[model samples]
Target: MAKYEALGLIETFGLVFVLEAADAMCKAADVELIGYANVASGYISVLVQGDVGACKTAVEAGVAAVKAMEGGNLYSSIVIPRPHQDLGKIIKRYSITNLVTE
Candidate 1:
């Protein structure tokens, strides 16, 4: 099983806001940034992994950060506790390790 107990996602309207949200998420809890996905048309989703509680706190912080940003518009956010193992197949592609090596 993966070490992470939960998966958190924060979607925003623009790159800048998503970046800010990512920063806030990492800083607010013991979570690891799992890189981000650009969903096109200025929409982006930042992912994070950690324990259930940490993921919850991180998502909250991320949403708040985006809301506080001048031009930020949050699309949505979620914390999935104990995600299905099958979900890992898709998440691996967006892992930070891939971002660092590529």
Candidate 2:
């Protein structure tokens, strides 16, 4: 199983409840949700890690669930075939010190 990572920007009518719901949905998909980081304006950013298929499914399901709960506006961007070595190289080149921290 190849590891994959996804960066999603989800917007909800209600921030708190929607964020919690999104978290639950991600957990159900067996995704390692890295939690949310409030970004520009009122959007919340979420990072997820899992198998490629699982990650894709999680992002889709999570977005759907959140939308169902309170009308969701989600943008999901996934990186496929993300091997650890490739990720490490990206981290090194980009000087991404907070690779796993945030």
Return the top candidate by TM-score: 1
Clash totals, every prediction: 0, 1
What lDDT would each prediction earn against the true structure?
Answer: 0.91, 0.53
- Model 2 TM-score? 0.57
- Candidate 2 lDDT score relative to the true structure: 0.53
lDDT of 2 by residue, 1-102 (tens): 233444333444346644655576577677665455455666655555666666667666666676565445554434344555555444333231454566
Deviation from native of the Cα of residue 84 in model 1, angstroms: 0.3
Give a tens-digit lDDT track for model 1, residues 1-102: 288899999999988899899999999999988888888898999999999999999999999999988877999999999999999888888877887853
Could you estimate the TM-score for every candidate?
0.93, 0.57
RMSD of each: 1.3, 5.4
User: Candidate 1 at residue 73, lDDT?
Assistant: 98
